[model samples]
Target chain A: MTTSTFSERGAAAVGSAAAAAVGDGARHLIEKRAAAVDAYPAMDAMRDRVREIRLHTLAHLDAYLADFADSVEAAGGHVFFAADADEANAYILGVAGEAGAELVVKSKSMVTEEIELNGALEAGGLTIVETDLGEFIVQLSGDRPSHIVAPVLHWTKEQVGHLFADQLGVPYADEPTELNQIARTHLRRIFLRADMGISGVNFAAASTGTIAIVTNEGNGRLTTTAPRVHVAVMGMERVVPTVEDLGVMLEVLGRSATGQSLTTYTNLITGPRRPDDDDGPDEFHVVIVDNGRTAVLGDEVSEVLACIRCGACLNICPVYRTVGGHAYGDVYPGPVGSVLSPILFGFEGREELPYACTLCGACLEVCPARIDLPSLLVNLRERVAQEGTAFSWLDRPLDAYEFAATHPTMWTASIDGASLAGRANRGGWFKRLPWRGKTWTSVRNLPAPAVTSFRRWWKKHHGA
Target chain B: MAAHTVSVLDATEGPIVVPSGSCAAMMIDHYADLLSDDDALAAAARRVAGRVREFTQFVVDDLGLDGLEADATGPITFHPSCHGLRHLGLRGYGERVLDHVGVERRPLEAAEECCGFGGLFAVEMPEISGALMETKIGHVEATGAETLVGYDMSCLMHLAGGMRRRGTDVEVRHIAEIIAGEDEA
Candidate 1:
């Protein structure tokens, strides 16, 4: 299909599947964040603090990760560093096997999605239940996440009603509060009966050897606490040097992410449940997954790792606003998604994603982590086009333009030819033209060039 | 090396000629940059800067282009791009130029919003960038203007691609030829 038809159909699909997924997702996120805009003077102030914390932590990543692993091991817990997604999945499945974990309760975690961990575990004969409300909805519907922060953003309340009725054998309800209550009651059983809890860490403190999980729904708290063995998976980059840095980052993260002064619950897990702690997991396993991120860090575009998964860029993005996130056809959507997806998945399947923008600076303005989004997008496009990673057709025009740009004589000739042709067709404008120019004029009128080119005018007037 | 010197000419009453609106505004805001202590550099800067007036402002105020007999028939929407509005502060210059050419100026909604075609940005963040252009195209469609005229070619180029992709029927033109009454030529 043509880009227009594809986008039009894709937009309609996204619009219909969920009660205006983008709008509802935006409304939910905005309502939450608007409360904090007044609470935080400027997004920049919080952003700068977050940047410092992330930078400081990244600098000491190795040392902190080692310390965190040491702590988990000392407290009779297990720690594994998976070089890639497959390795991470294999390691998690092995742990499930050792513990004989049949039913696994999971909190919202992007790392698991990255590693495809749940599928691996399920393949290993474990029934994994996602406890987070948004994640549970997506899991039930067997749909991929539309938004990073709000996974089931593409699903409307009515869709949720259908999915719940079909999957959980529950009565259909359209009210958000009612659906949420139904999900809560159903998930509460999994939380109580699960043999293992799998969760993603927001930040890991190197100094105290602690894992931090920030959530609004409190499902993360339950998932981590209810099971006998809690398995925490995190990206290698998700570490902080000290507790102070964690405190600073948390302040910025919650405020910038959901616009909450603080997430309803911020759980810090240190080496499993303590000996005296009544209701906490006894065995803790911290899995550090480094799938392509280490390679990303080595590149100039490593700054993308600084993303906190706030989805602020997505929320404010005009492109994401109009066509929604699915058009990009990636796990992550919107501005940050465009840059990171190509790097993570390579450009072969996603060549169309880069060509879909006007480069407005809104995404850059709203990013709380202050990622140089526009520059990264440009860098990726150049990589895709010039490097011949994908979309080989783009090279022709680019090369032609490059050649014309370099050879001034040819450039001037082309301009003059264009001007002459334009003048000839100038009843008012050229409705169509030959070659690629026709591609442009096919949809809109091309202004016929002046009878004289600018260069010619300069020569005539200034006697160059 | 020759030492630079400055010469102040008596203000001329005729049209103040300028090459571009951005440079013209710079002359007004940073005129001090032109008047260096060195006389020759000062004269050269002033001479160059003096030619940087808004096409319409220059024509209406300096050249009397508006008084000339011109065919003003077509209804065109005026989009004062950021550089022209923010950098040059040539507010309403495009409108005045269009009016002079005898074209009816159709006002566009959210006309001031960036078209997301920042030179390198179009290729960079295509998704978000395209999203912004969608908003811009929506505004242009709302105007129902036959032709979308703006001062910047870069913005038009990006918008033209987007309009094509969306299969919209609106024409983009530079303000220069429109005001010069050169569209027919």
Candidate 2:
């Protein structure tokens, strides 16, 4: 769906969910987040440092990535580079096939979502179960994550209660404790029996040839440990220079992501289980996927690669808060998604995602990486304007507006034209109009053109 | 029109004040970059950009808070459009304009948030826009003020539309009009 339709649907959905704990959750998020950032008075400095580190790393990404790959190799792990989604999926499937893996447990990896891994694995007749509670719920409902950080922000207790009852054959319960316990029971069976596991890398450290995964749940550990074959997918840009750099990134990541000092789980894995190690996969593989990331690295929006996937931009974004995440129609959502998705996937159908924001600059202030999301959105808007994808309808009206706005005579005439049109109309508003303005009148009435334009009134009475 | 506006700005080097914050912000922040490929136009745009000012800012800068004489009765609140609040970093100039006009000021909750007009965005995402407007209007209603005031007329327009649709008696006015004391009636 286009942004309009998505927003239209989202509005109805949010309105209904307001009395159903969504409001409480939003309130908690607001207060906790305020406290989180406010407690760290030097949050801006931390953000700046992280951004600088990311910028420097992205500039030398090839070297860091190569170093990371070699490090992984030295640590007794294999690395595969996939240029596209299909390649990434095929490579993972090939690894799963070699391991003779059937049931594969997955932690919440948006990279997997980006590559549509579950579908690919399903087609290959492999069962993939999402081990993260929220992902499991989303998987059960066959629904997309509506918020990047809180996947089921769109799902209320009542909805989840119903979903669990219907899908998990559990006794219906709306309480958080009951719901979580129910999920824990179901996901544990999959965790133990799964032959392979897949996860997303949050930060890959070139210094140690290590990958760190941050999660609030133990599922990440369970998913990484239980399977004999472990596969991790990472976008090429999510690498840091050193373990110390990873430490700094972590300090900001949890704080910025969910206002936590640290996530419950921050596991730094080097390779499969060593002989001394009690339990881990004998074979470990890291699938480094470009999938249009390298293209985004050199462009005007390369700063988007500075994103830490902390979802701070998403949490602070008003557009994401209102329309939710699905409106973006991309793996990533909110401010970062607006910039990154268009650059990664091209802006054919999803042009409105960039324009979806009011250019509020809220995302910029709260971002750990300090990626100037609004600026990048504007750049994307210009690119979409050039492509004439979703902006073609805007071309003529914008052209006419440009003509009228810049030409003093035309500008002067247009005011009078508006005055005349105001008089010609019902002396109030066009309740509903056709053509370009069709949507404006859908929810709110547009005031009829003024009887006298401000410029005209200023010029005439004030002698401008 | 672009050429003419550029020329006009060139001709009148000062005093190009606009009531709409977004209008001023576009020229001030975006015009040169928008016209970057055309050297002359871009240069001209830079000339125009440097001189433009938002209305409330202009009012405060030129006249100070003591310029106006009209005393507005009861409670009044100034709504800060996102363009003014976030984009241009406008803080209290609009309210200062209202104060200059002798209007009683009431603090609005969520004052710096966008009213969701967003030019065509209000139309394109009417549902979300309307939702935000509802939240804003709820704040306005919470203020229990007879008048809703703002620097941008588009914000007023959206608020007014919501008020009308909701059958509320609240009045929305531009800071310029309020400063002129035109709403004393």
Candidate 3:
């Protein structure tokens, strides 16, 4: 069932057993991430260096973006700078039409999801297939991806088995190896017959004009090479100044993402099929998507673009663990999404995203790039308050609290009143409350104020 | 509010000890930045910031309150509140204080995970906040501890409210209240 609004979705997920499963998966990854970082002491230094590299690259993005475009052209590859999602999709459709592409296979690309590229392609009459196992399951099930690195982390084996039986008309099999074989058998045919390949760029090296695609499965290689035309979609911030910078980025990305020293395959595609190349796409295209990135770059939350899409923030975020990804109601979820979504998609109706977090700062702790997530979230909240969208309801109580806080007499009077109320409650605790306070009382009781104010006690004891 | 706080605190000669972890963090980590525009208040904020110490940190680290004695009902678990643990870099000041008291301390699972009492967070996003509290309480119960102690009163009250609602036997206590050897609760 589709839930409306983020709060409704959050309430639904938090109460379900799925929350537990998401928590377990997140914890498992967190363990691996921690162990991987601990095992390689150099990774700590690399983390600091990568953050510097990302910041430096972003600072000189204008110069580097031009250099990147020039390098791609020099390497015999076409580059398209898309100001938004529509432009990105329109250009891709133009390329596909020129190639007369009918079937398209995609390696996992969050940028494509951000742009809603798959739906646009299918609408443009191209049959699209997701080559990533997790993404394939998500597509077959008609469900949105729930995690960054592991999209199907929310799905159980039994659920996938049932989805396969219902969607793929396959025999029921829940065993891991059997499930892998079924998906492999089903996807292998699409890989060969696919006319166009679409993949996401993990890192776009500006100096060399090489786009790196890191994947555990070999689908990234096949998706980039098997088809007659290859297209790479990347967020413009994915660019790094030098190939050496790309190496440091890759090191931190692998350790923080899945706790692996490195992914099984890291494909660095420079250009399309060359004179000496045995295999590759004939036409290579790179779509550098802006899609609100420049706006974010200008904003105070620009440090968020430094993210490498490592889901460490998600795995370590207490809020994400409880509500899962779907509750975020956006393509990007977790701490990064909370800050990015509202800024990217206007904070008009999406004001709740920043408040959804508890400002735990756990995300910053685990973040490989060490983006200050709490500060960004608080900044968005300040904007939301200024916009007066959702937080208007809080104005009255806050005003009263502020009044009480500023005025010593009123503060003392309020304290005395609350102390009297507390004295009325049995054992100085309230089992339930009414009105706005019902939010807390709905799930938990509140501690009543003490019978005597600390000031009163101090004065009486000291006889002051 | 910060300016008012600084003005009031500037008159005091003693170190200003903040009992709440989040409050202490705000004073130490954010005050100077918030007041930087006013040169006088900025210097004063820094002075207050330097003197500010989390209650448990001050007791254990500054006062050198070692080898103390206290009493509690059964094994207890501690939930390190997020602000104190991360911002103030409170490394087991409360736990070390408790160690001196010689209470049987049971390890709380995922001790560093937030208790979800993020100021307005519990009231604004109740479902998510309650869900996190339930997860935290589950670990607290799993420790089989009769008492749960934490540095922040906000987190303790949140956990206590959830426990009261669930009819769980675990009691919540602030580390200060426990250190004071009070039977109130």
Q: Using lDDT as the measure, which candidate wins?
A: 3
Task: Give, for candidate 3 chain B, the lowest lDDT window spanning 10 residues.
Answer: B176-185
| Candidate 2 C-alpha lDDT tens digits along A218-250 | 999999999998999998998999999998898
Query: What's the TM-score of each model vs. the native?
Result: 0.76, 0.92, 0.97
lDDT of 2 by residue, B1-185 (tens): 55566766777756788888988888888888877888988998998888788998887786466647654576788788877777788877777667666678888997876777777777667777787788888999898888888888777888888777777778887777665667311
Q: Which residue pairs collide in model 2, if any?
A: A406-B1, A406-B2, A407-B1
Best by DockQ: 3
Error of 3 at A345 (Å): 1.5
List candidate 1 segments past 4 Å from native.
A1-20, A27-35, A74-76, A347-356, A430-443, A456-464, B1-134, B140-151, B157-185
Score each candidate by Cα lDDT: 0.72, 0.81, 0.89
What C-alpha RMSD does candidate 2 show over the true interface residues after superposing them?
2.6
The CA lDDT at A132 in model 1 is 89
Ranked candidates, highest DockQ first: 3, 2, 1
Q: lDDT at B129 for candidate 3?
A: 88
For model 3, the docking class works out as: medium
TM-scores of the candidates, chain A only:
0.88, 0.91, 0.97
Model 3 TM-score, all chains together: 0.97
Interface RMSD of each: 8.0, 2.6, 1.9
Ranking by TM-score: 3, 2, 1
| DockQ, all models | 0.14, 0.55, 0.68
Report how far residue A428 has shifted in candidate 1, in Å.
Answer: 3.6
Q: Tell me the spans in candidate 3 whose CA falls farther than 4 Å from its real position.
A: A1-3, B183-185
